[model samples]
Target: MGLWRVFYAGWQMECCGTPFSVGDDVSWQLLLVPGEEPASRLTGPAGHVAGATDGIRVVQEAGLTVALSEDPEPRSAGAGPADPGPVRRSGLLSVETHGGAWPEVTGRVRSLHIVVQDLARGADGTWEPVPGTRTLRETDRCPKWFRGREFGTDTGRRRRDEQGVLVGLEVPS
Candidate 1:
């Protein structure tokens, strides 16, 4: 079996399950179920926002099947890069798990280490890179993905009011 890591960020943002390691050319469906009350509370008031459940539901229901391989490689569409970006710091969030069917034999995503990446500035100048870490605040709109492909794509969108502040760091993966 090969290992695959899946990440979900945004509203209802707790990471779920362990990294899946399965056989080659295999396809499986993933069901992203609603988290329990304790987990939901951890998300705070931001979890009550509009479309939050829908987004989470999509990730939950869109089960992923892995093609087992002697060589380790992911075969899912929309899968981000293994090395997503530059690593600015250590000790971010990470989770591990054995490969298997959706919603079955899955493990709770504990406090895994992640390398948080640094935020960058845009041409319109809405966000500026600040030094040090702050709480990730809840915003009127959903939190921004700042890095990845979505950055700078929609310049006219309004910024969301931040709620909880998380210390920002840059990770290479």
Candidate 2:
């Protein structure tokens, strides 16, 4: 079993994700993001995002296919109806990246960890986790994202649903 640290975001869960627990067999669409991407560091300053937790592994790295749409533009662009085209094997994995669906990774959850970080906007307009405000809470269930009055409304200081699960998943071969 290849153990890897996978970051699952909170909004992704609240949108189309289901609550999962340790030892539960689950499948999720995953995007292989380059570590250089600023968003990739969602898991802390060490590169943690407000809602990303680590700890996912892969069984195989190849032999995967992702469904893609031919038209990359928005439907409102007067591009007529959208077509989901055909499924193609993603050899480079980075070929034709878009905002839609991604390849699904399936596996059993080996562990779960929730990440909580208090973030404040800096003078440079970048958000960073506050000192001593980063904590990883061990949980069996993935929590849902919620919007509260105290969230993102305090003069540059606000609480966010930046909680996520570190699912140990098996990337399809």
Candidate 3:
């Protein structure tokens, strides 16, 4: 069996996503993201032991309708505006890395982790996660997305953990 940590974003769940629980068999499009990416901040260490999957430690649950944007780093230094690419409503999600296709992961949920984080006002007047305020709670039921208006983002409270779901899945070889 192969164990993997999967990140299911709250916003994705709130936006027409089906909720799943522990022990449920599921197939989801998984994006292989580098550990240093911004979105990887929400995930735990990778558990899959595939040799070619290095640097793809973090996997995110990709929605059917995904928003595409131009690669930010490759833009010219003086580009006037960043062009947000057209929305892809392909109803399919997948990624290819190292000349291999990683379309979806089929597995049984072994465990669920709800990520909780404590937020503090940064010097720049933005809410940032406290250095060590991250914790995970084991749960069986999928999370419900709570709308938060304070920071113009969902789960806008100082101390919140009910938004993100980190699923531990066991894939059969």
Candidate 4:
């Protein structure tokens, strides 16, 4: 089961984005979410896209990075290999005991979709969908994303802060 399926009482992850949307590195740079706010999404070779997810209420914009690494990094202490989830370790380098074992791990992204729905926390601190928030779900609530055969670590995003300050960060999974 997916984390969404585990946490969401009733929700769905719909994919309307094709290989043309975010997969084409030559074309896709930015796209606006289909709605009133028209949230502009900037996707990269990395595992996440940055955009405005908050609707009319809060103006909070965030990046939802996905886990995309095939062979995770060996620990500094060399504990053990971890599951390929959110490890953020992808590049043209490796230190695996079986060196270069993941040649197929181009660290490239395939496709992505936004899980649009509101979460409600009860007194027990469990997450459930609000009755009204269910109305927010859609076939394309957020633009579906795809990736080319690019290394996830090879790309990053340039972000400007509230004060118009600019900074760059690696697009991690």
Candidate 5:
């Protein structure tokens, strides 16, 4: 569980539960109970209570009559950094293309996706020839056509051919 404190205009406020920031143009009114001594109060430009202290408790229960008013300012989405979920450690590999000829390209499988493919060992002693795989032909060179191509790498570097065409084959770590 996460714990947080409540505050009003920098002055700490007593609250049994977490307090959320009020949006702009919105006003909040709270009551307080008077104590034996006089309470210190700070009022805002609009006569809204900004801060208070000195023998006064925010009216958590009935019968107390201390009034607090506030018009909170609007909060913009640019006020803070957005929460980017978990960092994904994946890579993309691509083969180079030659003069007017498209290199035969294959996609790399990642994690659980590898289980769905039939696996075989190549002369290099690495797993090769995934089942249900498709090959890229030279005619399919449009950028939009390769949008969903898959490739994996232990490092995040993209693999490319000598001519700089992406081959989409990851070197195993």
Candidate 6:
């Protein structure tokens, strides 16, 4: 696991419904599932907006992926509509891969994007999607092999909407 210091510019964010602001000194702990490793520093970026500051994508693993600061754009799959936009990844989120049980990160709801899909499995081996969320038309909508349950910060990774149930990931801007 890796540790990181998060900096927000008072953009109005939350973790699992708990509101927070700049200078909060939130601790971002990055944990990778089995066979996973950090592709780069926890403070390094995976990518950035067309021309914005480059952000870092944290731990990378085969089963689970986590990124700190990056940009993710989720598109509509089949019946799904266009992704409203990428979420601001001031906060990091990630999920266990390989269809294993991943405990939801307990925090305030991220204001930017929700990183979950419709066919996600809970830590208890249940097919649970974000509440009120429908299934994704296909896996193509997600980054690489991630199912619909993947979520990231507004800057890093993909999209989905849920409270503290967000997952941080990395991909192209």
Residue-by-residue lDDT tens digits, candidate 5, 24-102: 1212223312231113232222221124342222211111112322112323766642222221111111111111221
Error of 3 at 4 (Å): 0.9
TM-score of 6: 0.21
* Candidate 1 Cα errors over 4 Å, as ranges: 14-63, 66-111, 128-173
lDDT of candidate 6 vs native? 0.30
Every candidate's CA RMSD: 17.4, 11.7, 12.0, 20.1, 29.3, 18.6
**Span of ten consecutive residues with least summed lDDT in model 4:** 1-10
Per-model TM against the reference: 0.22, 0.52, 0.54, 0.18, 0.12, 0.21
Which wins on TM-score, candidate 5 or candidate 6? 6
Return whichever of 3 and 6 wins on lDDT: 3
Candidate 3 residue-wise lDDT, 45-130, digit = tens: 22222432322222222222111122222457777543333322111122222232234567888898776666756778787776
- lDDT tens readout by residue for model 1, 1-173: 21233233332132332121222121222222223111110111111123222222111111222111111233367874332122121121211133232222133222222223334456776554334422333222222332222234343433332222121112111
Cα lDDT of candidate 1 equals 0.25
How do all the candidates rank in terms of TM-score, highest first? Answer: 3, 2, 1, 6, 4, 5
Per-residue CA lDDT of model 4 for 18-42, tens digit only, reads 2222222211122112221212232
- Candidate 3: what lDDT? 0.51
In order, the Cα lDDT scores of the candidates are 0.25, 0.47, 0.51, 0.23, 0.23, 0.30
lDDT of 5: 0.23
- Decide which is better by lDDT, 1 or 5: 1
Candidate 2: stretches off by over 4 Å: 36-98, 124-127, 146-161, 170-173
Number of colliding residue pairs in each model: 47, 13, 0, 1, 11, 37
Candidate 3 or 6, higher TM-score? 3
